[model samples]
Target: MAAPRAVIVHRTSELTELLARHGTRGQVSFFLEQRGQSLAAVEERHDRTRAALADVTAGLPVDWRRASVERGELARSVFEPDDVILVVGQDGLVANAAKYLGAQPVIGIDPLPGVNAGILVPHAPAEGGALAEAARTGAAPLCERTMVRVRTDDGQSLTALNEVMIGQPGHQSARYTLDVDGRSERQSSSGVIVGTGTGATGWCSSIARVQSPRLALPAPTDRGLAWFVREPWPSPSTGADLLAGLLHGDAVQLRVESDQLVAFGDGMEDDRLTLSWGQRVRIEVADRTLRTVRSVR
Candidate 1:
């Protein structure tokens, strides 16, 4: 059996990226100033994030195996059954990490405590140590959040804690035949987003808001999913009648007619699947859930 491991998942601060791109602090300051921004604000946020990380690092038990992964490296990171994930960034970071995890419990540590949005990342950084210990000892309460999965006929699959967007590149309309329940329709639309209850609050909610009655979304704990087709174009050969619906105990299938299309989750564009014409894809609620700590204290 693998030893209990604690994985710290964090995103690179914007200031750090700016410094790397501009080659120096002065250059970064100059670049930001040109855009009417202040370097001080960015630096302050960076310092606070780093301080949070330091406290969390200091709190880890010496006997526990430890590792850290940046946001960009999450898709490539391997997670074990006994691992405990400490997400020390925004709530979105939890979403980015959730798809890769199995049953391992996650602790969301907001680098900035008071300003917390109380979404996914809800804990203060100071609680990292005790939380990990509690999780390892099986004393931590767990909450399950629903997720969605998309699989291609080629044997490739992707999971999302939020939603999966399958579309053509560069705003070009995507051509595909969509299948739901027993009905099917040929569609020419911007894309399709199949989302879970957790995703219903973000992109899915915004997308549904544009509808007349505003589509109802599933709850974070619900196994069902809600999906939408963006701006389905109406024409002689195509139909927009099947634009929105729910997925419960059923999978939504799409066969691509476009030359190229891609599917990505949670706005992580770099990690995506590229599909070709004549490819078939299946989307449904996933078997795996994002297991998170129930309480922050």
Candidate 2:
């Protein structure tokens, strides 16, 4: 049997030592995340780092390559399946990369303040202690789902970590139609929230709170859970009260009979979907699972 291939992801500092340990015998590859660094910076840093790794590995047979791609190329390059890719970046970069890369095993090596130390480890650890156990036995843990594109009216598509939302499309308060399991439901509201378990922390949580308050305390599933409400926040006597009310529903439908409104994700306008008063908008969990790599610690 062949030895499992491992990829060392690190800045330059720890690269040499990693290569010395992993590159001595089996197949090894190196992926260096530039982390939005400028070309000049990466070149200068890679030069020093690469030289150090060469010294440590000496005659060991290792295939080393730098992941040199522009910012726009990130989604395409990072998402592919490979042996193993180590990453050296902060949480944000790791999260974005994980979104595209199918949740492969990712090791994060946070750069020191101004001083780069490339020690690599998984990005986020498993929810419990599962990751730690896997690492102890040299096993890699995979996240549940990967990125997916959903089709909507007018040949439009939306990428989501949780769900696709449609609400007061445009500047007018959104009105839309909704159907659950093929049964039509009339709705009037700001918009609709479609999300997966991963997105529950953001809009999904908000929508579900209003639609079916009970879903919040339970674990999410692939079947995709959702709810519907008849109001949008702001009419409440207090902001705290509004929030409290919003969090208690399963899904929410905002009533906007006047002008169109915009649907947002993580707070940004995602895209426009037709909506209106008395219209029912559907909100549900997606069928796809987004895979992620978590640490054993």
Candidate 3:
């Protein structure tokens, strides 16, 4: 048997990013002042995040092996099945790390606590140690959150904990042949989005609300997904018949009719799949679920 490891996944704080962006802390402070935002707030958050991460690291069992990685480095980090993932930050960070993971249990620790909607990150920094032990022993309660996957014809696939967006990079009109449940049609629109129940509150909800206000989207732990086509354009060659619907036991398929198209997950544009003309992409509910560890304290 392999030794259980604790993996702390985090991201550079806003202050840190600002410093890198402006080349100095002094410049970052001036930049925030111009926007009527005080640098103190950002500094406080940065400190909180660092302290929380330190606490999580210190709380791990003395005998357990540990490793840490920033959110941007997740794609490059190799994870083991026995690793307990500790995500220290807002809920979005947990979602960001989800696509790079498999079945490992994730413990979301909110450093700022009530500042952000703590859906994915339900635990606080204080419970880090208990959460670690619970997850390691498989005694922690888990919410098996569903996810979405987009696969290209050439065997490339990407999973998103929130939703998968397929269209042009800046969301220009995307031309494609929409296929669902064996029916197909040529359509032109902003693009397509397939989201899991976990994505409901994010980009999926913002669009779903306007497209289908009466539609009931799946809950966090639900099995189904809500999908929608953005601002479908109707022309002589294209029809906007299929606007939106709930997906369960079925997947949305698209064939690129334009010169080029791209598929990205969870708002990650840089990391995406490029599809040329005559290519096909399939959007479906992913088989892998994000197992989030609940608070054991």
Candidate 4:
């Protein structure tokens, strides 16, 4: 039987060299690129990648391919189940590649070493271990980190890796009704965030100071939701009741007079949801979860 194919992804100059060194030791490697970005930036990254590759594969009998998945057919051809895709730099490419191929085992590489690779895989726990089952058996669990389902007021459902933020697109403050689990509260702020563990470090982190609770499940504990209230009116003070209610999956309702309000997930702009004053914005815990590959040490 042939050894499983391991595709090594790289970006920065130094890391590419590291991958080349690792690849010569029996690992199958490939180079992946994105569609749109500054050419100067791309050339710079590419040059760095080549230099790294040269250093690592100095005397090895190796062949590397610059596979561009620009076209639809090309993308389909690059992503296959038998391939174990490894992303070396950022998670953007890996995330995009997963959309094309659902069965491939995608892993993130930690360039700095000791740093958390944060490699999210499409695996779930079962018999044996999640990692073993994923590597040898190719058994895909029902739940994956990419399994996010969000329902909007427009009767549309969406998914994202990061937190969903609610904000108004104008200078005027967005007055919204926040409903957590079952209770409701009025809010007038720049925006509100409904985030998951995966997105806690992003927008959620930016808005407030969130510490990873040492507990088994590190749910975000907010002292109180912050509202960016314009001068003249006092800032909306999120009380303990609101904080407790939000943590427990209470649905929040937000109402605004203007239709300039917007709902964003993972920092992307979602369609304008039709809502009225005192319209309830439901914020609750989701059943779906993200599966991440962690380091042994």
Candidate 5:
């Protein structure tokens, strides 16, 4: 039998993007210099990323097939069940890749180790080969991270590794009917955020910091979701009592009362579900979880 393929995922470097926009490296350097900056740091970071990619590519086992995809192309990229995923970018790229993956094990490699506070990227580039080997051999230590899901009544659905945002497109107040447990409330607010335990330290934490002080956020592996209604306004017709809470059992359902509302996951605004007036959206813990490879050492 052939060894399972390794799908390496990455994003374009800032330097590369600058060069593409300016048409040349010299133009990029000149553009930066005009702004009192030099291209040395950008060039250094780019070089580090290139070196990391080289190290990871060189580390793959001889028998394993390898494939590469950019972060922007993940939506259209296909993965086999046995394929191992290697994400070479910051923590957000792991989240970006997680939604498209099924049960595959993912190894997050930070190209620049010390420079990034990688919450999801736990492996350094030097460990890339070892991680790839372990993943192929089924010997990698795994961490199961919970994810959030949003399903609309019209059969549209989205899953998020970090958090899901339901709101109007332009930061306008969103009106909706929120139903949880056995109770329901009509609310007019800025938006709604549904987050998983793996996202507790992110947007959910920020919402918890100011809105619900008594809410204890879940751990990364916890099978629960935290939700917050941003800037809920209390009116005679709308209530603010159900501003924030934890969702566990049956999904928390929301009915849109605005002209249009959007549901986006993991901060990918371009990829979203459109919810028109009177449309219902159910937010819950995703049936699938992210399997992240952790360092054995």
Candidate 6:
């Protein structure tokens, strides 16, 4: 059998991007000066991220096979069932990597823990080596996070860790028919969002905040999903009665009545499914769940 592999996923630092665009530190300094920002602060952040990456790389077990890739290239990356994933960035990085991963155990490491909220990145760089080993050995504690799955009748489907957005690509009102729990309504609004328990704190929470304080959202590990329709414009032909609700067991179905509608998951706009008028889509809980490593301490 082959030794388990580790794939470290990261994004380029802002400092590197600045230097790439300006071609020199002097140019970067001038650009920052124009905005009243200090280059030293940016450099410090860049150094910290570099140090974190170095720490994670140096701590890996010598026998383990290791590879690294950037966030943008995740769609092209391949992973084996035995591979372990290490995401060294903010919460969004982990979310980005989760969609492409199957059953691999993921260790979410915050490269700059002090500056980041690290909601999804529970591990720090110093712990990356240990977490990587634990994942390889099947000893790491894991939390199964539910994901939202969206599928079009034409055989297109995608999953989201946070939430799935179904609406117009250019911020215009999206006309559609929403069906949930045997109740259906014709809706003419901005769009609809269906989110998993893991997504309750994000866009879902913001929508829930306005509806009612007592509207309880699902926990991160729960199998349920919450949904909301943004700015439903009630016209003589359309009704706004079915604006918000929960979806579990039965799928929430939407039929596009507009010229074109888009469905994207986890805020990956570049990766999306386009639906034309007369197309129908269903949103439900995905069979696959994200196996995220939790802090052993």
Residue pair clashes in candidate 5: none
Q: Candidate 6's error at 49, in angstroms?
A: 1.0
TM-scores of the candidates in the order shown: 0.95, 0.47, 0.96, 0.51, 0.95, 0.96
TM-score of 1: 0.95
List where candidate 6 sits over 4 angstroms from the true fold: none
- Candidate 2 structure quality by residue, lDDT tens digits, 149-203: 3443334334555445555444333344344443333344554555555555555
lDDT by residue for model 5 (189-269), tens: 999998988889777888899999899998889999888889999999999998788877767889999999999998898
Off by over 4 Å in 2: 1-62, 68-79, 83-138, 146-149, 153-155, 168-172, 181-183, 206-212, 216-221, 227-287
Each model's number of backbone clashes?
A: 0, 51, 0, 22, 0, 0
lDDT (tens digit, per residue) of candidate 6 on 181-249: 899999999899999888887778888998645678898889999988899999999988987788668
lDDT (Cα, 0-100) at 284 in candidate 3: 90
lDDT of each: 0.90, 0.40, 0.89, 0.42, 0.90, 0.89
Model 3 residue 149 CA deviation in Å: 1.2
lDDT of 5: 0.90
lDDT of 6 at 192: 91
Candidate 4, poorest ten consecutive residues by summed lDDT: 121-130
lDDT score for residue 243 of model 3 = 86
Candidate 5 segments whose C-alpha is farther than 4 A from its true place: 34-36
> For candidate 2, what is the total of clashing residue pairs?
51
Error of 4 at 239 (Å): 10
